[model samples]
Target: MKPTTSEMEILQVLWEKKSCSVREVHESLNKKDVGYTTTLKLMQIMLEKGLVVRDSSSRSHIYTANITEEQTQTSFLDKMIDTVYHGSTSRLVMQALGHSNTSKEELAAIREYLETLEKS
Candidate 1:
C-alpha cells in the first residue's frame, strides 16, 4: 500500500533509527509540531496497513519499517515517472535538474552512474 505523506514522515524516522518507539518518532517529528497521540495513532494505522511491524513484547512498542528505503523509493519513482513524466525518464531528470541547483559533485556522480549503465 502507498503510504500517505504523514506515514512517509514516520517511515523516514524509522529508516534512520532502524526501530523506534512512538515516543522516539514523536520527538523526531517535533519540528513538524505533530502531537504525540497523532503520531501514535498514525503508527498504529501503519501497522495495520502492513507498512510497519511492531514488537509488542516490551513495555514500549517498537516499530520497524516493513519495506526497505530502496524499495519504497523505487516504487514511488516508478509511479511518478509513469504518471507525472509520461514514462519519460529523460523528462523527469531534465525537469529535476532544471529546477534544482545540483552540485558539481552530484552531477559528476550522476554522470559516473550513467557511464556505468552504458558499459553494462
Candidate 2:
C-alpha cells in the first residue's frame, strides 16, 4: 500500500529512530502544525495498513517501520519511472540532473556509480 504524505513523514521519523513512541514521532514532526492526536491516529492507521508495527508491551507503544528506506525509495522510484517518465530511467535521470542543483561531489559520485554499472 502506498503511504499518504503524513504517513511518509511519520515513517521517516521511525526509520531514523528505528523505534519511537507516538510522542517521539510527534516531536520529530513538530515543524508541522499537526496535533498529537492526529499523529496518533495516523500511526494507528499505518499499523492497520501494515506500514508500521507497534509494540504494545509498554505503555508508550513504540512504533517501527515495517518497510525499509531502500524499499520505499525503490518502490516510489519504480512507479515514477514507469508513470511520470514513461518507463524511461534515462529520462528520469536527465530530468532530475537538469533541474536539481546537484553538487560537484554528488555528480562525481553519480559518475562513479555509472562507471560501476557499466563494468557490470
Candidate 3:
C-alpha cells in the first residue's frame, strides 16, 4: 500500500531506528505536537495495511517498516513520473532539475549513474 504522508513520517522513524515502540515514535515526532494515541492509531493502521510489522512478545510492542526506503521511494518516483510527467522520464528529470539548484558535483554524479546504466 502507498503510505499516506503521516504514515511516511512514521516509516521514516522506523527505517532510521530499525524498530520502536509507539511511545518512542511519538517522542521522536515531538516537533509535530501529535498526541500519543494519534501516533498509535496511525501505526495500527499501518500494520493493517502491511506497511509495518509488530513484535508483540514484549510489553512494549516494537514496530518495524515492512517496506524498504528504497522500495518506497522507487514506487513513489515511478508513480510520479507516470501520472505527473506522462511517463516521460526526461520530462521528470527536466522538471526536477529546473526546480532545484543543481550543483556541478550532482551533475557529475548523475553523469556517472547514466554511464553505469549504459554499461548495464
Candidate 4:
C-alpha cells in the first residue's frame, strides 16, 4: 500500500502507540501541530488505504495497524535506497555509519542482524 505523506505520519504514530482511539491519535498528532480533524480524517483515509483498521465496538474506535512494521520499513527502505541512496545500500550503510554515532548496543544488534543474514 502506498501511503501519502499524511498517511505515513499517522502510521508512524500508530506504530509507536499500538492500538489507539481517534481522540488519542488526534491529541498525539496535535502535539506535532497537526489539527485534530485532519488527523481523524487522515486516519479514515488510511483505513481506505488498508494501512489501518478501526473497531467501533469500543468506547472510541480503537485503531490498529493493518500493515506490519517490518513490511512498512522494507517497502519504504526499498524506495529510499533507490531514490535517496541511488540504489546503493552499501552507500547507505557507509553514510549512516560515518555520519551517526552508533551505540555499542546498536552495533551489537547490527552484527547480530548481519550474522543472521549470513546464515540465510
Go through the candidates in order and give the C-alpha RMSD of each one to the true structure.
1.2, 1.1, 1.0, 2.3
What is the C-alpha lDDT profile of model 2 across 44-118, one tens digit per residue? Answer: 999999999999998789999999999999999999999998999999999999999999999999999999999
Q: Model 4 shows how many backbone clashes?
A: 0
Candidate 1 has an lDDT of 0.95
Ranking of all predicted structures according to TM-score, beginning with the best and ending with the worst? 3, 2, 1, 4
Model 3, 8-116: lDDT tens digits are 9999999999999999999998856678999999999999999999999999999999999999999999999999999999999988999999999999999999999
| Candidate 4 per-residue lDDT over residues 1-106, each given as its tens digit | 7788777767778899998988887777766667778888888888887899989996778999899889988998999999999999999999998999999999
lDDT of each: 0.95, 0.93, 0.95, 0.86
Clashing pairs counted in every model: 0, 0, 0, 0
- Residue 63, model 4, lDDT: 98
Tell me which of candidates 1 and 3 scores higher on TM-score: 3
Error of 4 at 37 (Å): 1.2
Error of model 1, residue 48, in angstroms: 0.6
